[model samples]
Target chain A: MNALGNAFSLLAGGERETWWTIATSLRFSLWSTVFAVIPGVPLGAALFLGRFKGKRVAVAMVNAIMAVPTVVVGLFVYSFISRSGPLGSLNMLYAPAGVIAGQALLAFPLVTAMSYTGLQKLDPRYNETLLTLGARPWRRMIAIIREGRFVIVQAVLAGFGRVTGEVGVSMMLGGNIRWYTRTMTTTIALDAGKGEFERALSLGIVLLGVALSINFLSHLAVRDAR
Target chain B: MHADAVRNDAVRNDAVRNDAVRNAPAFSVSRLTFRYERKVAVSCDSLEIHRGETVAFTGSNGSGKTTMLKLLNGLLGPYDGRIDFLGLPLARNPLLRDRSVFVHQHPVLFSGTVKDNFEYALRLKRVRGAEAAKRIAMTVERFSIGPLLEREAGRLSGGETQRVAVARAVAAGADVILLDEPTSSMDSASGSAIRAFLLELRRSGTTLVFSTHDASLVLDLAGRSVRFESGRVVDEPSTGGTL
Candidate 1:
């Protein structure tokens, strides 16, 4: 009970920092979702709607990537951006950009795979109906995408939630530098590891709040989809 | 039969026969074949649908009625032979896309409000603002879908959804409306409404080709019937079921 009281007091006292942390996490998530969705949606749409040889292989690979370990993604990206690595000259390491990159990679396959599932579940007759209406290919694509908007929205929310609360990528790639590269997850990790239990618990509570909000939104989107 | 009824029937039959010959066929399929993998869905068939005429294609399940409709709109390319729509060969010229439209058996409704679903086809064609609104209103009134315009499409009943689907297709300015079981899932009231709409469409010179399993419905609407069996058209009217 004392611990919970201390945690709440710490959160109340550190409201500014808490809000900053939340704002930064949101910024990162928004950019990551934008980066992920741009290519992810079209790729998923093509893989599910287009008919060509080896399409199955592409879909299989994306589905496999959905389960990719976040730590593994961090490690893999770390190798390429580290001081001695190929992209080392960019010096993106230990920055929010690097964290975004890692999160984008982690989120992309998830968004794509879920979007693909949504598109595949659509009735093929929709495509045919559009084509018959003299809709151009681009037009047909838009119509189908618009029809599947609810599913796409849910996929994006899920992807955002996955990245916002993820620790492995931010911890490894951002180096957890306070007020520089530190996100909520990384802050919580650093505070907990250093025995700043109140701060850590505060961050943890905030992260939980974020997760719950995202889950609520996703649930609403799915209900709207039906 | 009553004298007035006999006269009306004779005049209707004559008008149908004359129209069949006078109006150039909106769709002409010659020696067409379509296959999925190694199995044939439709084989070496010839058909022509005249402009402003309502033609019905009837057959048992898997008789290729749906496949034939798909061919008219370039939804499926033919494996052999040719399909000409509005004097353009669908294979050689892609412009048939500009003038033809198709409606599916199971209507596709988007996840937005009813107005959004109705406007989707027009928006694709780049119609917007007041012009788009006018056409939408016209269609909504025509289909009596005014109450449904603000409702989410996903929440509509099957019959209401089908009405919106048909309205959207028609509003897209389809020179040819191909309905695949448009009324298959509707209640009697909705079915009657749709039938009335199709009749009005016919009078307005829109060419309609539809497939149905309902014999009586076909008899009431179609001027001619084309029957298929085992992937081929059985030519004799004796074998071909009457509309």
Candidate 2:
């Protein structure tokens, strides 16, 4: 208990390096969410609207991707970004950019799956009125998106939460480089490994605070969207 | 003028307009059929609607009255049949949709003001600038819904929403307005307002094809009444029909 109290002092001490790690983690998570949502929204909306063959198969594939372990995702991305791999020429290995890319990949499934489920629940009356009013094809699609926007925002929040909590992908692809790629999750793991239980516990508390903040903000947004 | 004199004046006016459309049916259908998977939704052997006609399709729920209105407005294509609209083959003509609008039974308002909803329809029909503004004002006045013009349209009462739906249809300059239970959601006052506006539309030569279970609406607005039962038109020869 004394050690935990000391850790709290260390955290509350406002050290510049610790704050930098916090900032870096948040920046990477934000970028990851931004990238995932771009392609994810259109892809998810199309998955709902497009009536081609293999639709069930495509949806199943998305659900399967959502179940994949984060460690496996890390390993798969590491292979491509490693020095001897095909994409190594870009020299992104052991960099924050690689972490962002890996985290974006992790968040993509959450964004897409939630969006698809959200739009699937839309009322059929929206489409019916638009079509009967002689709305052009593009206008009808835009109307559909607008109608499903609340669910889509929730999808985005879920992606943000997932990326912010992820440890495996950020640690593996980012290589935990000190003062550069070291993030909140990676520092927590490092502190625990070195038997620095106090720092680990304090950082875990910080992570918990951040996660709660995100969920609280999302709840407010959900109410507003409603 | 006396009420009977006004009725005779309308009849005479209809005759004069009929002369211009003497050769062509407003809509002609033969052996029309529609199916939803294994269930037949609509089936009719033959039907024709003359120009400037006001018709009502009356039946119980799921009796294919709404299905028939949808087929007429080209919102749903017939599984097997030929439909001629305004002297053109409906299947090949892309302009048929431009000439008609269907107000849904439960109207879904766009996410904006009442003015915006009416403007969207006018814009789609390529009416713009001063012309579009004029049309919007005309519709608002015609429906006596000037008070609801600035409010969020989706938050309106059921009757107000239907009024806006019909107004938007008119703003598009559609020659034919197909309404699927436009007044089923309204109170008596709102219903009478809708009927009066519909009569105003008829005077301007806009044909109205509506579906309703309201016997009074059919008696008041429709010159022809088509009755449906079990997904089939049971009215023929001696029953309700257009002459």
Candidate 3:
């Protein structure tokens, strides 16, 4: 009850800060999705279509990645971007870019695994038809992707949902600095820890809204893909 | 890739031939064999099909007719023997598949509208604008699928999807259409419609090689029928041994 009351209070007095946090959250999630899905889709399709050796092992690796903890991802990326690490020369530590990199790694496995199952289940008859019709290699690939778009789209939206609400990656990699990399989830965590219930509850509401929206869209896409 | 064989790149006979017997056979094979996961699916020796011939491969389940059809269309390959398309070996005729389309037992209508499925091949072959439109229109009307053009292909009834699949193959203008049980699961109305469509295709000079367990369809449609059992075409020919 107190959290609900605090949320309304924050809504009245903290509109600008709330909007900024939401914007940062959206930006972080969107960029992470882009980075993850660009490579995830082709890799997923190739894993499904290619019949060479050790494909099962590759697929198993992706499945294993999906089970990894988000905090572990945060730590791995944090270590890489730290001043003493190999990539430290870039000075990305505690920056929004570091947050994006960590979150992208967190999302990659989900997208690949989902898309692989999607393309794997696709009827092989379509490929044969395309070949017999003399579709050029590029055209065939594009057509297959388009036909398989629903699975990829669902994977992307699911990844976006996960990344949007994840506090560990942003808290560790972005340092959750106010007026800079402070995203909805990270701010909510920090505010709650400091007993600032209104700001925390308000941020929680915004993050929940984003997560619900992504879930709704994913539901529609899965149904439509059928 | 044969080391000790003469390459018959000339895909025509040297002598003049009568209209009844074409100079080039549609498919000529010697020792054609295929295996799937340690089980021999097809093992045929010395088989030839002529142009415009309607050949039915009748067999029980798991008898390898479908596998043989796939091999003929270049979908499965690297078999035990040579397959010549119109007197030229597969190695010399890379465009062989462009001339032969295979329709599966349960044709998969991909995710799109029926019109999209019908136009997929034409667009692939780069048939553009008015020509593509005209062909699509002609095919839709000819196949009696005009009402279904706007329906989602993936949402269609099984029989409706099969009709569209057959029409798509026809619209693509493939020389040889290999169908595996095209009418097996269809309702009587749909079955009769497919039967009529196949007859029309035959009249249009499109060669058809289909597998079926339906003896009546073979009796009504095929000029030649070959029985298959245990992965080999039995010597009993329904018509003359050679057409």
Give candidate 1's error at residue A128 in angstroms.
Answer: 2.8
Give per-residue CA lDDT, model 3, range B41-116, as digits (tens): 8998878888898999988888888888888888786688888776656653644755778888888876778887
lDDT of 2 by residue, A1-226 (tens): 9878977887899877777888899999999999999988777877876667899999899889987888888998889988899899888789988998888888898788888888887777777677767777666666677778887888888888888888899899998999999988899889889988877777777788888987887788668666
lDDT of 2 by residue, B34-69 (tens): 998868999988888777888888889989988888
Better of 1 and 2 by DockQ: 1
Worst 10 residues of 1 chain A by lDDT: A131-140
Q: lDDT per residue, candidate 1, A103-151, as tens digits? A: 9999999999988898877778777777666666666666777778878
Name model 3 segments beyond 4 Å from true: A11-14, A75-92, A195-198, B1-24, B77-79, B87-93, B137-157, B238-243
Clashing pairs in 3: none
Model 2 chain B TM at: 0.85
Candidate that beats the other on TM-score, 2 or 3, i.e. the better one: 2
**How far is A72's C-alpha from truth in model 3 (Å)?**
4.6
- List TM-score per model, in order: 0.80, 0.85, 0.84
Interface RMSD of each: 1.8, 1.5, 1.6
Candidate 3: C-alpha lDDT:
0.81
Error of 2 at B231 (Å): 1.4
Separate DockQ for every predicted complex: 0.45, 0.39, 0.58
Instruction: Compute the lDDT of residue A135 as modeled in candidate 2.
Output: 74
What is model 3's DockQ versus the real complex?
0.58
Which lDDT values do the candidates have, in the order given? 0.79, 0.81, 0.81
